[model samples]
Target chain A: MSGCRDWLAHLVLGLGAALFLLPIWLAFCAATLDPAAIDRGELSLVPRLDHLGVFLEVLRHGGPGVGPVWRMLAVSAAMALAIALGKIAISILSAYAVVFFRFPFRRTAFWIIFVTLMLPVEVRIIPTYAVMADLHFIDTFQGLTVPLIASATATLLFRQTFVAIPDELLEAARMDGAGPLRFLWDVVLPVSAANLAALFVILFVYGWNQYLWPLLAATSPRLDTVVIGIVKMIGIDTSTEWNKVMATAVLALVPPVLVVVGLQRWFVKGLTEGEK
Target chain B: MERRTIFPGWRLPLLLVAPQLLLTLVFFYWPAAEGLWQSLTRTDAFGIHTRFVGLANFAALFADPRYRSSVAITLVFCAAVTALSLGSGLVLALAADRELRGRDLYRVLLIWPYAVAPAIAAVLWLLLLNPQIGTIGRWLVALGVHWDYALNGTQALLLVIVASAWKQVSYNFLFVLAGLQSIPRAVIEAARMDGAKGFHRFRTIQLPLLAPTLFFLVIVDLVYAAFDTFGVIQAMTQGGPGRATETLVFKVYQDGVVNLDLGSSAAQSVVLMGGVILLTALQFRFLGRRVAS
Candidate 1:
């Protein structure tokens, strides 16, 4: 009976994992199929190579007012960079100061930053949009990038990383006539490279995958990220072209999927190994 | 090296924190405060005209049947997704905990969905479940169970819940697997020696040890359901045939963005934020204690 139960559990787990990954695999398969074939409701497990032309069409055919894939890629890369860089710079500096210094409101500042975790961007979407409009930043890259620049989670993660650094390292740098700025640049950053890499993957993936904010902020097609673009490709009309949508979906997923697969080791370490 | 603090002690920390603080103050705190203020007032299109109506917006939202339905839907969605993800995640973690072949392959395949954006997930599922040509829909029809998310509200809700749950199961599995791996083999062996096996051993020994990880996952899952799934809903059903899947966050987006009812939208946001804050605090207060113990 015990052996039977164990086998059942294993079977169930394998089935569950297959089901969980089905949609992703199916979407990719559908993306590679010809629109005519898809429209005919032909369900083929293996996507035919002849249907690969849809990718080229999706890239070349600027549907309606939609920009080219290269333009969309540029905008997404630029906006993602701005947000990631701004967030990392601020988080690193703030974490450095908080970990090293003993200043007034030190504890209070830390608490405030931590509390922001509870106050997610979704909660403040309405007001944040209004603020963007007020600042005349609506539909601009700055609007998309600025509101997300200060991530409480990143700050907390960086602070945890900084706190794990040995105190003796900083002290030794101090004794060797290294100033705070020099010490941070020379000693601290080197030791924290792994942590920073981990955080970089987390932040980069996050900024890349961000959707609602860009959706709300970027009203025009000009500023749409790959996410919003793929969503828009879902089509408001009932006769929505499933093949085109799937093709666009495949394109949108490629960058972040590649990033995750490439930096997966650091990503896993950042999430799991950090707490210890 | 000398104890000569560079340029007054407060200057450095302040400067260090300046960028983040400024960004947060401008983007987060200011908007949060403005949202509170807007919830109590009336605002016009183009956001130029405004009037202080004071609690009328809140009163209207509370009195509306749609708001009430949204509250119920949001609760059901959050609860269902949380239970489904956590239960499946725990089972998968437990199964994967054994020295099984192809373990790494299973792990990678299981987490593959986590890499897909929620918008894409919704889109993919909608295609697979479409009434006419959907692969699953065709299969269901073949099995004699007529399943059409477009026509059936319960089916639509269940589909959304499943989609969201599937997207997150990987994350939960990752955490739970970590937690399970951390448990010493001696404990399980000791339990087995005491005649604890199968469900008995799992329930008493493994579950107790897994509580901390489970607690963390619950909080994280709640937040994701509430805040993160908005895009999914937007892409999947657009709140559906008759407001069936109109979650609070989706409602807020519809009101603020689509409908242009900024005042009511702000009111909804405030209420949503209040509920989230309450839920988070309750989780920390209750499960946090258990974990600590």
Candidate 2:
């Protein structure tokens, strides 16, 4: 009976996995097929491995109204890295400041960052766009990344991690004659390294997956992240390059998927713990 | 909770926090204030003139039939997406929680969908459900089903909901699975000894204990369906087939960005801001003690 139950569990889990993996598998195969065949509604379950050059073809020159895949991927990578690393850097300092030092108005500073969490970019789109325009930051990399780096999530997570560090650690550092900066560099950072990695994966995915912000902020095709580029590729139905769209779609998901999968343990840990 | 041991001088700490403070003030607070101001004021068709009209935009928004429908659409969308995603996530989490072989591999496969961008998820669904080029879509057509989301309003809404929920299930699954694992083993064993088995045991024993996690997920999922699924809706339906899928967030974008209706959009933005704040406050209010413990 237990064996039967195990079999039932496997079957159920397998179906759930396939529900996700099948669409992607079909997309992979569709990406490799000739564009003419796909247009004719002749999608195959099997990929034509020899036609895998479509990935490179799309990478070099994208479909109508879309920039090169390589550039979008680069922009996305840069945005994700900048948002992740920049957020980590600032959040670490700020969290460290709030946790370690007894500064005046420190709670005020923390509350200010916390309040920003309620105002997602979606709610304040127009005014934020206006602000971006006023700064002349529109259609620029700074426009794409910098404003997004001020993350309350990272700050809060780091604060949580820092607060849990025993008071003895701080005393030991003080006893060793190390300054705050040195203690942070040596003790604080090393202790929070795992968290940093986890937050990196989460924020990296967040930055890479941003669509609405980049859609309104960056008008130039050069500033298009992969997510925005794919949307544009499919926007025009007149002479839609189905194969290229599929290839670009695949390209878009690969980096973030790889990051999440490679750091699966930390990503899961951070996601559940940080959010709740 | 205040810390006991601390670094003394305030200057270093203030310096450390200044960058985040500056960015938060300029980007977050300023934009929020601008949205508030814009909501209360109107701009002429020409870009030149602007005047404060005091609640006029809000009054007009409430009076507009389209805005009311958008609100209804948003509520329904949030509800459906939350239910579908959370339901499937629970089932998957439950199935994976058993000591079955290769459970770890099942988890990795199940959770990777979290990484798929909402826009990319839309594109993938299009590849499956596009009437002409889609594999299953073509099959559905051959089976005499009217399967075009592009032209059909109901179909379009369904597609966006599924696509939005698809991208979110992994998040819910991670949380639900964690919640399941966190339940004490002794309790489950006691339930088993009480002769409760399989579906009966889950319904009575596991389900009740999972309430807090479920409550937390509902709020998160509602917020996600409200805001984050913009990419999904924009890519999939563009909230079209005659405004069938246009939730409140999409309406704000369409009015503000495409039509350049700044006042109405700002009003909608303020409304959304209120909704988010309420949702967030409720989450913390209900879940604060749970989180603390």
Candidate 3:
């Protein structure tokens, strides 16, 4: 009975996995088909080999009211990188400060950061946009990344990690006449390397997948990120090149998927270990 | 949570925390405060004169039937996405938790969908269910059933809900699986010895232990469905078939960005902020005890 149950579990999981991938596989197949074939409303589950030129065509010839696919991809890549790096740098420092030091207004500082969670960018778009406009940061990279990175989720994660560090490491560093900075550089950092890697994977994906903020912040066609750019290509009209749109969707999913797959080990380990 | 080790410093810590504090102040606190202030004030469409309207915007929003329906729509959407994502996630997690072969492979297969952007997920679904060329659409037509999300509010809502839930299943599955693994093996052994097995054991033993995780996921999924689903809804339905699928977050965007109704949008923002604050409070109250799931 146990053996049968185990096989049943496998079957269930296998089917679930296939269900999850079906839409994506359909998209990939559609991306490989010509526009006429797609418009015929009879999508071939088996992809045609010669129609692979759609990817190149979408890349080379920009769609209506949008720039080239490469530009949107580039903008997305840049925004993701900048936001990931900027958030990590700032969050690491702040988390380090809270966990490693005794200072005035420390709790207040933490609360302030925590209170930022009260409203996500979606809730406060109007005033946040107004703030961006007031600073002339609208349509700039600073505008695209800065406001959205203000959350405490990451800083809190780092704080938890920092608090878990063995005190002996810090004591030993202090015994070696190390300043706070030195201890942070040599000991704190290396100790938290796994966490930093995991957060990088997460923040990069978070930054890459941002849609609402980017849609609101980055207005210029040249500045459009792939997530926003690709969504715009779906004009809901009959004239939309469904094949090209499908191709763009594939390009958009590549980077974040690669990041997650490559770092899956670190991500899972960090999550379970950190919690336990 | 206090660390016994001490690094005594006022200057360096201040320097260390400055960037985040500055960013938070400028981008978070300042904007939130401005949102509150803006809700009380109305500006003409041309950006001419501004006057403090006190509670007029709030009154108008409360009286607007569209806004009230958006609230109902948000709750329905939230409940559906949460249930669907969590339900599927629990199934996947339970199956993967069993003594099965190729579990590692199954995990990686399921988790990568978490990385797909919500908007991208929506588009993939859009293609899959496209009335013109979607294979599923073709199947529906072959069955003599009309399926057009673009023109049907119910269909549009269903499409958005599926797209939103699809991306979140990865997150829920990861959490649920972790929760399952953390359950002690001896507990399951004890349950087995007591003649509890399979569905009965899952219900009597595993599920009660999984409550904290289930609750945590509910809060997190609700937040995701409410706020982060702006992309999915925007891409899939744009709150359309005539605002039938419009959630509160999308309403904020539509009223604020699309219509440029600054006062009412800010008021809506304030209301949405209240909902989030309430949820965040609930999460914190329950979450701090559970390693935040």
Candidate 4:
């Protein structure tokens, strides 16, 4: 900013970046190493390249007390995507209804949904688990996704977006005898596409990073998400393959990080704008 | 907040809202009500022979030294995490806000950590902090420091705190940077014209403007530290080394899931739900005033 500030800024930022990357770099290096090498703990800076196959090895066969990495990856993907889309769909609908249509108990219904902000599945996991068990949805995709899909954040965001849409456009749509569904499909959705896209990235990451819900809901080994499996693998009392554990951790983080980086612009926009 | 143009059909709105309402009722309100109810009742080991124990579970929780310890650790954890993450985040944001070379590259590098799941972040730190074969752990040992989180409760707590804060710094950075950038260029120019350059201008002008953002970040980080760090504690320490790292969130899980102490867990959940409601209310109050003015 000032004459002497440039170098200082760069230094500070560079140090921060290095601090953040150091762990991941170590993980990456170890992931490519033989178990014996990792056991030695030299943690060579130079790539060993001897066990590049560890990634596939870990993917094909998981460590103790865990399933195949690919299936865990798929479960993570499914949970993340389902939560994202389900939240977007339900929130958009509810937001549209609350913002655009006046009903008898509209305010009551809105508060009912809004109060959900207070209780995450974490805070109420015991009861939520009981519900899941009662419905026989435990270990099911619906259990992992449905309870998580009702999003106060997205609903609030969509409501703000929908409310910001000029009255003129909706009136114009109505003048053409367009019904509510048609108006939502053609006008509201198209207008809110940016918000929706931004929200998708945010929600996808939120869903992908879920730890406790999947841990509780999916007890079946086949259903264990990577986040859960990583802990289970490391949590076991037996000997842990540090290399594979690091490899699996790498697999666990890569997708969500890619989503954030690939959609960087929208992610920031959604965070700041959605907060407002 | 009324929309001027409206869809006039009541039936359609009802149908549209039904799915969300149903899901909310099924997953949210019902369980929340149940959590509340469970907090009031005590069940035997088998969940049968249930009896109403109004406020007994809560009283017992407060009476229990372990619960108090959990709350104390959570408070301490929240304090350390909020300070560490927010402070580093502010510095990072300030540095990255400059028009230096490759600032965008730095920003991208810093922000991607937000995608790291909390447990994975813990695992990352575990790899670096584990005394056996860890990088920094070896360094610490070489420096004559006894670096073992497994056997030492304080070290375990510190490890979880650092790892938790590390995961959160990226989030705070984004918000802080946005807050910094949102300070109008014209205002900064005006301050600079008055010889309020560098740290003087920032401390006098920019910091006050960024107060609201800082406050919001503090609360956000507090809630994150309290609730969202279950994964980190679970993965890293499992609340071990004599229950040192056991925060309220983890205790809720441990007691409820591992120990099957449903009443205690439910009571704790209710308390946590109260915390969330209070935090949300604080946020909305400040936010509402901000919007109003």
Candidate 5:
């Protein structure tokens, strides 16, 4: 009976996994087929391994209203890295100050940042664009990244992590004549490495997956993130190269999916715990 | 929650927090305040003249049939996406938690979709569901189902919901799986000894215990379907088939960015901000037990 139940479990889980993997597999196969065949609604389930160079071909060119796939990927990578690292750095500093120091209006500062949780870019679309315009951040890389770096979630998580540190540890660091910065470097960072890793993966994916903000902020095709670029590629569907679009979709999926899967343990920890 | 042993000076800590504070002030607070201010005022088409018209934009919005329809569409979209995603996630999480062989492998396969952007998810689904060139869509056509999301409003809305929910399932799966794993085995064994088994055991014990996680996921998923699926709508339908799939967020974008209707758009934005604040407050009020710990 137990053995029979286990098979049922396997069947259920396998099907669940297929719900995700099948679409991508079909996409990969479609990417390998001829574009005309795909446009003719003849998508195949099996990939043509011989024609796998289409992924390379896609990287070299752009569709109508789309820039080079490689450039978009590079833009996405830069934005993701800047947002992830910038958010982590500043969040760590702010969380450290909030947790470790006695300061005036510390609570006020924390609450101000916390209120941002209520104001995602979705809610403040036009006015935020206006602000970006005012600062001359429109169409610039800073416009794409800096405005997104201040994170309430990362700060809250880091503060939670930092608050759990033993007072004795800080006393010991101080006894070693370590100043605040030194203590933060030598003790705080290393102690919170796992949380940092978790936050990195979460924030990296967050940064990579941003679509609306990028669309609003960067009008120049030069600054198009892969997510934005793919949407543009699909916009002109009549003139769209189907196989190239599929291949571009495949390429776009690789980086963030790799990060999430590679750091699966930490990513799960960060997501399931931090978000709640 | 402050540490007992603290850093001595106010200066260093203040300096440390300055960057985030500044960014928050400029990007978050300033924009939000501008949105509130814009909500109360009107601007002409050429951006030349501006006048204060307190709550008139909001009044106009409520009176507009399109705005009312968008609200109805949003509520339905949120409910459908949340229910579908959470339901599938619970089922998969339950099956995956059964101590089966290769469960770890199954997990990695399921969890990676969380990384796929909402826009990319739309493209993937479009490849499968596009009646002209999509694999499954053409299959549906061959079956004589008259399936074209482009021309049919209801079909377009359904497609958008499916795509949005598909990307979100992995997130809910991760959380639900964690919640399931954290349930005490001893308690399960105790229930087993009491003759509770399988579906009965799950419904009676595991499900109730999982409420906190479920509640948390509901709020998150609703917020996601409300705000984050803008990309899915943009990429898939552009809220098309004659304003069928246009949720509030999409309409905000449409009115504000595309139509350049500053007053109405800002009013809509203010309303959304209020919705978010209300939702967040509700979560904190009810889920304070879990979040506080």
Candidate 6:
């Protein structure tokens, strides 16, 4: 009876995992096939190699309203870079201060950042949009990237990483006539390289996948990221050409997918280290 | 004796914190404060004209039947998604916890769903389940089971819930797997020596230690459901089939963006924020203390 139960459990989990992976596999098949083939449902399970031209067409011809699909790629890449750099720089510095210093309201500030995890963009969209509008930041790069730079998660992770560093390292640097900034650059950051790489990949993925904030803040066509572009292409009428939509979807997913594949090690490391 | 400085005092902290502080104050805090102010007023989409109605918007929202339904739906969605993801994630973590063949492949495949954007996930599912051309719909028809999310509100709600839960299981699984691996194998060996086999070992030795990871995951998943999946709903159903899937965030987006009723949307935002804050505090008070130990 126990053996039978264990087998049943294994079957249940294996099937669930297969279902979890199905949609992503279907998406790849859909993206690769010819539109006619897709409509006819000819290649339902397996993709035909000959129809790979559709992806190339999407890359070359571009989708409706948006220019060449490559333009969207450039936009997403630039935005992701800006968000990653901004988040990391600010998080490292803020984490340094929060970890090392004794200040008035220090605990309060730490808790404030921590609590912001519970207070998400959905809860504060109205005011954030208002600020963006007030600053004339709407439809600009700053509007798209600035708000996301203040990530509580990154700060929390960095603080935990910094706190784990031995105090003697900082003390030794200080005795050697290293200023705090110099010490941070010379000693602290090098020791934290592994954590930094992990955080970088995580932050980059976060920026890459951002949707709502960019949708609200970016009003101009020139500033649209791949996600907003794919969503806009879907159209409220649902009359969008599925071919182009899938093509755009493929485009939007590539960078982050590549990042995940390339930085799989860093991603896992970040997850494990962040939990610690 | 002079207090010798180990590092430069004040300057480093100020510099390190300045950028994040400026951005947070301008973006997060300022908007949060403004949202509070906006909730009590009457305003247009563009904010060109505004009048102070003093809680009238909140009163109207509270009086609306849809708002009441939204609150209930939000709670149900949060609960269902949290339970499903956590439950499935734990099972998968346990299955992969052993020295199985192809374990690495299984782990990779399980986590691949998380790589896709939620918007794309919604779109992919919609295509797979569209009443007319959807693969799943055809399969259901083959099996003599009627399935149409567009006409059936329950079907639509269930689909969204399932999609949200599936998207997050991998993420929860990653953490749970890590937590499982971190358990000292010595403890499990000792349990086995005492004849704590299989379920007994898991329930008595494993589950208790895994509680902290599960607690963190539950809170994180709740927040994601509340905030993140708005894009998915917007993409797939648009809260359709008579507003069955119109979650709190979806309604907030609709009011603010589609309907262009800024004040009411702000009021909805405030209510949602308040609920989340209260729930988080309660979670910390109840579960967080136990997990911390």
Candidate 5 local lDDT, A106-155, one digit each (tens): 99999999878645788888999999999999999999999889778789
Docking band of candidate 4: high
Error of 3 at B271 (Å): 0.6
Per residue, candidate 2 scores C-alpha lDDT tens digits across A34-91 of 8889999999899999999999988998878887899999999999999999999999
List pairs with backbone clashes in candidate 5. Answer: none
lDDT of 6 by residue, B115-218 (tens): 67777777778667766656786678678877888788888888888878887888888899899998999999999899998888899999999877787788
Q: Residue by residue across A63-153, what tens digits does model 3's lDDT show?
A: 7657889888888899899888898899989999999998899999999998775467888888999999999998898889888777688
Which ranges of candidate 1 are over 4 A from the true structure? A1-10, A62-65, A273-276, B1-8, B44-49, B283-293
- Pairs of residues clashing in candidate 2: none
**lDDT for predicted candidate 5 compared with the true structure:** 0.90
lDDT of 3 at A19: 78
Q: How would you class the docking of model 6? A: medium
DockQ score for candidate 2: 0.84
Stretches of candidate 3 exceeding 4 Å from the true structure: A272-276, B291-293
> Per-residue CA lDDT of candidate 2, range B143-191, in tens?
9998888789888888899999998999999999999998999999999
Chain A TM-scores for all candidates read: 0.88, 0.97, 0.95, 0.96, 0.97, 0.86
Best by DockQ: 5
Candidate 2: stretches off by over 4 Å: none
Across A1-276, the per-residue lDDT of candidate 4 in tens digits comes to 465788888888989999998899889888888777767677866656877788898899988888799999999999899999999999999999999999989999999988887567789899999988999999888888888998687888899898889999988999999999999999989888778878888888889989988888988887889999999988875677888899999999899999989988878887887672
Cα RMSD for predicted model 4: 1.4
DockQ of each model vs. true complex: 0.51, 0.84, 0.79, 0.82, 0.85, 0.50
Better of 3 and 6 by TM-score: 3
Ten-residue stretch with the least lDDT total in model 5 chain B:
B284-293
Ranking by DockQ: 5, 2, 4, 3, 1, 6
TM-scores, each model vs. reference = 0.92, 0.98, 0.97, 0.98, 0.98, 0.92
Q: Show pairs that collide, candidate 6.
A: A127-B31
How much DockQ does model 5 earn? 0.85
